[model samples]
Target: MNLRNIQYPFLFEVPVLKHMAGFAGLLKRDPRGWPSDRPVVGMFLCLDPLIFCCQPQPRPFGVAHHLATRFPDETFVFLVPITMSLERRVNALALAAQHRRFQKTHPRASLIILANTRDEERLLRRLGVDVRYAPQNMFVDEGMYHPIPGRERRFDAIYNAQLAPFKRHELARTLPSCAYVTKMFTTWSPQLKRQHLGKFVCSLPYNHVILNDVTADDVVPMDHVKVNRAMASAHVGLCLSGLEGAMYASIEYLLAGLPVVSTRSRGGRDVFFHPDTTLIVDDDPRAVQDGVVAMKARALPPDYVRATTLRLIAEERAHFNVFIDGLRGRQVDRTDPRWSFEYAHKLARFGSISEFEALVRAR
Candidate 1:
C-alpha cells in the first residue's frame, strides 16, 4: 500500500473528520517536524521581517519567527529587508543561517527568498539563489469601511496608524488644517503626549480613537467603532508610519474611496505606485500637507481603487497557489522527523492555518 498517497477529503467536505483524526492521536503524541504521515511536497520557511527592537515585520511572516525555532521539518520562504538598518541586516543573516542549517539537516528542505526591496533581490542572487520580491498586501473588511450617504459631516479625515515618536511628529507637520482621527490616545509618556498636543493644537482636531491613555492597549471598543465610522464620513485617509509592511489602514482608506496621504516608505511604495491610488509624501510635513490638499481637490474613483485592491489580492492568491504547486519538489524520507505541536502553533501564527491544519489531519 502507498501509505503516503492516502486521499483524504477536504476539511470542509466532512468537518467531523478532524475530530475523528484527533481521537486517533489521543493515545500516542505525534513527533516533531514530520508529524504528518501523509505526503508533503515541500515546506515553506517564513523569514522575519521586523528587525527594529529585535522584532520582525508584520507581514510576510507576521510574528512567526519565534515559532520557527520549534519546527525544523518544513523549508522556509523568507521576506528579506532591502536597505535595512545595520541591526536588521545582521538579524536577516542570522535567520538565513538558521534556515540554511535546517536544509543541511534535512536535505529535502530548501530556501526560497522573497525580499522587500529590489536591491535585496540582487543581493540574494549574488549570494547564489534567485530570490523573488513579494510585495505586501493590505486587506480590509469591506463592510466596515463603506461610506454611508448622510453621515458625511461626522469626520474630515482618518489617520489610523501607530503612535510612535516619528509618526506623531509627521502628523503634526503634515495635517495642519486636517482634523486627525487616531486609534491611540495618551498611552505614551506624559512628555510624548504633550509633544503631540503642542504640534497639532491649532492646525488639527485630535480625536482619540481610544479614550483612556494607559488602557489604550487593553481594549479600544470606542476607537474601533470610531475608525469604522470615520471611514464612512471622512473625505480623506492618512497614514504616516515611518516603518511599515503593507499598511492595512491605507488599504481600508483606499477601499473606502478616501484618498490617502501616505509616507513614501518601502512598505507603502508598491501600493501607492498603482494608478491613481494614493498621494505619496516624504517624511517632511510640507510634503504631507501638499498631498492632503491634492487629495481634497480630487479623489480617485471608487471603482478604480476597488479594482486595484482586488487585483493585488488576486495576485497574492495566485502566488500562494503557485507556491503550493511546487511542494512536490521536496525529497521526502519517511524516517525523517515529523512536525510537533509547536510547529502547528508556528504555522497558525503566520496565517498558514489551513496548511497547519492539513498537517494535523495528515497524522
Candidate 2:
C-alpha cells in the first residue's frame, strides 16, 4: 500500500500560510496520549459503548488508522464531513492507504463516514470510503437553542459567525436591519465597521463573546442561551460563507425559529433547510437584502420552523442508531435507542479538543 502509487493533488497540504496557521493551532493543543499529528475528536456517541468520532483531516485521518489497530473492536470510527470540498476524499484516501497496511492481518475495515450531502456520499463511496448520509449539523443540541415566545424582533436579520474575512460580512451590508452576533478575534470588528457598517443601523448590535458578564476577552464564545436570544432578536438568520463545513449557525437559526437567507454555499447547511423556511439568494448585498425582506414578509411561524427542524434532525439520529445497531447486532442501547446520541452536544464541538484524549483515555 505505497501511497505514492495513488497520486492525487494534496491541494490543501501546501501553501505556507495554511500550514503555519495549522501548526500554530496544534501548538495550543494538549498533546497527552496522542501526538500533535493525531486528529482531535469531534464527538463520540458513547465512550462506554465505544463509538469514536474521527476528525477527517489529511494528517489526522492517517492517525485514525493507527487507532484502529490498538482498539480494533473498540475503535469504531465514525467520520463526519468537516468541509464540502475535494479535500475530504483526499484525506479519506490517506486513511484507506494507511489502514490497508494492516488489512491482511486485521481482516476487517473499521472506517465509516457520515456524509453531509448526496454528493459527499457519492464521491466518498466512489473512492471506496464507507460513507453514510448523516449531516453533522443534525447532532446539534436542540435543548440549548429554541425560539423564545414573543421575544422582540428588533432587526430584520442576524448573522452569527466569527468576524473573519472568509465570512464576507460585506454581503450582508445592504440589509436595512441586521444584527451581528459575532466572536471578535481581536481588531476584526474595527475593520468590519469601517468597510461594512456605514449607515447600517444594527451594525455590531450584540457582542456576547464573553460569558458570565466578562468583557475582557471577545475570543470566548457566548453562552448558548444568550446566542439563542440574539437569534430570536431578529426575523431571519444569514449564512454568508461560500465554502466551509456544515454551518452550525444556520441550524441554530432554524431552531430559534427564524427563517434563513443564505448565499449559495458549498457546505451541507442545506441538509436541514426547508425551501419555504430557507431562501438561497445570490452572493450579493442586494440579493441578500431582498432575501431578508422576502423572508420577513413571508412571516413563517416560529413554532413551525422549530418543530420541522427538530423532526429532520431526529431522522438523521435514527439513521445513526440503525447503523450502529446493525454493526453490534443489537440496538445502541437496549433501553434507549438514541442512547449513543445522548452524549452532550458540546462534545461534538472541537473547542474542547485538547481535553478529548484525556476523557477517552479515562474511559
Candidate 3:
C-alpha cells in the first residue's frame, strides 16, 4: 500500500532559535506559540521491499531520500513515523542522512523533518538534523466520546475487536448481561477473514451480542467524547486484539477513568499497566470473567486513575514533541542531563540496552 496516500499535516516548523535567545538554553524553555500556517503534510512511505522479517532495511534509505527531496517541491511536509525499538535511532539517522545529503545537493527544497518516538528524537539530535516531534496522531481524545450522565447504561462491558479461532476459543462462552461488541463488517485480514465469518455465524443464542464492525454505518465506536463517557458509565472496557500498536482504546479507557480488561496483546503490554488502570489477563475465559467481576466490585478512584493515565500520556507526548523538533532542524540539548543522549550513546556504542541491563541485573 502507498503510505503517502494516508497523508497527515506536517508540523512544528518554527525554529527553536527564533523562540529563545540561545540554542543551548532553548531546552529549558517551553514553546508558547505555533505557526498559523501549517504547511507540511506528514507522509509515511511504505517500503515493504525495504523490510526484512518485519524490520526495515537500509535499502529503503535511497527511496526515503528521493521522497523527502521531492515532497517539498509539491509544498507538502513529509514525515516518517516508525515504531519505537532499539534499531529505531539507527534507522532514523540513516534516513536523516539521506535527507541531509539531498538538501545539500538541492538547497532550495522545502524539506521539514518529523519523527514520533523517543529513540527517533535522540537519533535526530545525534545526527544534528533539523527534526521535530508530533503527538503520535492518536485520535483518542476523551472530549469527543464521553459518557452521558444521568442516563442509565444497559451494557456492562463492551468488547470490540476481531473474532478469530483463538479469540473465540478464549471467549466462546459469554458473561451474563455484558454487551458483546463485535464488528458488523469484516475487514481485509487474510488470516482471520474466514475465521471471523465462521465465528459470527456460530455466535448466536449465547449472550447479548452487539455484532457491528467499524465499517457498519449504524454502529459508531465511541468517538473521543463518547469514549470518556463510556469509561465512566461502563463497568469495564475490554479489548482482546490479537495484535496492536499503542492501542488507542486503552488510552481512551484510561482517560475515561474506566478500568480496561485486555489480553496480553503486543503493543497493549507496552502501554497498559496491570491493576493500575488496566487488568492484563491471558486469553483465558475464567481470568477475564474474574477480572471483570473484580472491576465491577470495586473500581479505582476516578481522579487517581485519570491523573495517572494523563501523566503517562504527557510524558509520551513530550518525548514525541522533542523528536519532531529534532527532525525540523532543532536538535535536543546534549548539555541537559535529562536528555536521552546517554541512552542513545549507550545503545549505539554497546549494541543493545536490554542485553546490557540484563547482564547488570545478573550481577
> Largest TM-score belongs to which candidate?
2
Q: Compare candidates 2 and 3 on lDDT and give the better one.
A: 2
Tens digit of per-residue lDDT, candidate 3, span 1-363: 223211211111123321222222222222223232322222121121111011111222212333323333432233333332212233445556655664675464334443444445566767776555433323234344343445454556665443433234345245664554443223334433444455454565455555344332324444344434444545777776544334455565656666777777643323535467777777877777777777767756655666776666566556744653443445545553333222221011222323322322343
* Stretch of 10 with least lDDT, candidate 2: 4-13
Candidate 2 residue lDDT tens string, 1-363: 323211211212233443234232222221225553444546665565556666554343423454555555554544544443433444445534443443543454455666677776787677676667778787777888888997899888888886455677778776667777766444334544333223232343343121223233333467887889888889999999776668789999999899999998865888888887899999899999899999999989998999888878888887767776665555444454444455657334453444555655788
Model 3 off-target regions past 4 Å? 1-77, 82-139, 162-169, 182-198, 211-233, 268-274, 301-304, 329-363
lDDT (0-100) at residue 49 of candidate 2?
52
- Candidate number that wins on lDDT, 1 or 2: 2
Clashes of each: 19, 0, 38
lDDT of 1 by residue, 214-328 (tens): 3313223344456666676666777775544555666677666666777766433354345466767777767777777787777566556666666665665456334433444
- Candidate 3 lDDT score at position 69: 38
How far does residue 32 in candidate 1 sit from its true spot (Å)? 12
How do the predictions measure up, each by TM-score?
Answer: 0.57, 0.71, 0.51
Error of 3 at 253 (Å): 2.0
Model 3: lDDT to the true structure: 0.44
Give, for candidate 3, the lowest lDDT window spanning 10 residues: 46-55
Off by over 4 Å in 1: 1-91, 105-107, 111-114, 125-131, 138-149, 173-226, 301-303, 328-363
lDDT of each: 0.45, 0.64, 0.44
